[model samples]
Target: MFRFLPLPEGALCLIAATAFCAEYLLFYFHSTSHKGLEGYYHLILVLLIGLCVVSSVAGALLPTSFPVDLTNGIAITLQGLWFYQTAFSLYGPMMPDGCQLTGDQIACGSAASRVRGELLANFQLFSLVLGVLVAVVVSYGYAASRHGRS
Candidate 1:
């Protein structure tokens, strides 16, 4: 109902990117200590978000005749990435062949397990944020397109 924004695409992308930034800043940072690595990660993430916002705005500004197939493709790609990430986290350090803790290495292994758990939890949290952002963006885009028509 509030589809007055000129660049709904940019708005949606901004929302999603903001969620991603929050997740990476809050949860993922706890899993590592390498300042250099963190810097690199943040750099990559910022660039990615920047790209998304730019593309979204460009898409919105272009002629409506522009094909939406690319948007659909991106949505599909993100779904696949999210699924892959979720599957990877499901196999956290467990047993059989996971993070097998030997006798003397129990302490160190336990520590590793704790770290792994934190990582997985962060992953899940980020995944949730991403999912919500996607939903909001898609919904906003749909509403904006419909409103644009009338």
Candidate 2:
């Protein structure tokens, strides 16, 4: 809707929230058929997408809130990071032991290995989030020291 390009101020956030909401629904429902490690990863992704949806809506309500904006950014960042982690772990060289790419599906030889893979996925997502938060905090401190409110 190009006609609605210049949406009234905070309306932009609501629009973004709507988009994120639609994405979350698509992924959440579609993920039911994903199966195994793939399903678990998709579930994590869907949850993060839901977070983005919530944050965007919050941003609409609190347009000037820095924390709301930061939450939205971090959620989006984590979602993107998780996608990359999935690509590398499930489809790239980092595939867990006892798992193999058979045709187009990841086939783990045992339930334990699949569980291991899922835990690894969770750890990777957590690590990415921790790294981003640390970076943000460090940068904020640097900026505060040099250019923040005197």
Candidate 3:
């Protein structure tokens, strides 16, 4: 199935898989720690997983006419991936600021939040790498597809 798909499509699939693994591992470790406000972190992780799924599907369906207009399916999918990465990971640290939890709960919450931040940073890194790979693949695919035909 992937044989005919553009390189960007395959790369996005790999990126999505990588993101899911990171999310799952991060949550698994946090959950086992009996941390506070773990529910919120888990919720965010679930959202990331959803984003990954969307990216993979959209990339697969991206038209040959994409990388032309600004509203292409592939562009939308890439934007979604960027938004998810930036909003969730880089912004995760501030999401739990000034919590109402007290004592041990507060400590646990802060620690849990830090774990989330670390995970977010890692996710963003992977996203950035994936974005670059997608660009490269798309550029090459576009040029290759157009060569000798135009």
Most TM-score-accurate candidate: 2
TM-score versus the correct structure, for each prediction: 0.32, 0.91, 0.32
Task: Report the number of clashing residue pairs per model.
Answer: 0, 0, 0
Q: Cα lDDT of all candidates, in order? A: 0.46, 0.88, 0.52
Q: What are the per-residue Cα lDDT tens digits for candidate 1 across 78-147?
A: 5345444434443333321223334422222354554554554455547655775688689779988988
**Using alpha carbons, what is the TM-score of model 1?**
0.32
lDDT of 1: 0.46
**Candidate 3 lDDT by residue in tens digits, 84-133:** 55454323443444343454343334676666655644565566658766
Query: lDDT at 12 for candidate 1?
Result: 53
Clashing pairs in 1: none
Candidates, ranked, TM-score: 2, 3, 1
**Candidate 2 on 45-111: residue-level lDDT in tens?**
8988988999999999998899999898988888888888888988899998888889877888999
- The lDDT, on a scale of 0 to 1, for candidate 3 is 0.52
What is the TM-score (0 to 1) of candidate 2? 0.91
Query: After superposition, which runs of candidate 2 have C-alpha atoms over 4 Å from their true positions?
Result: 1-6
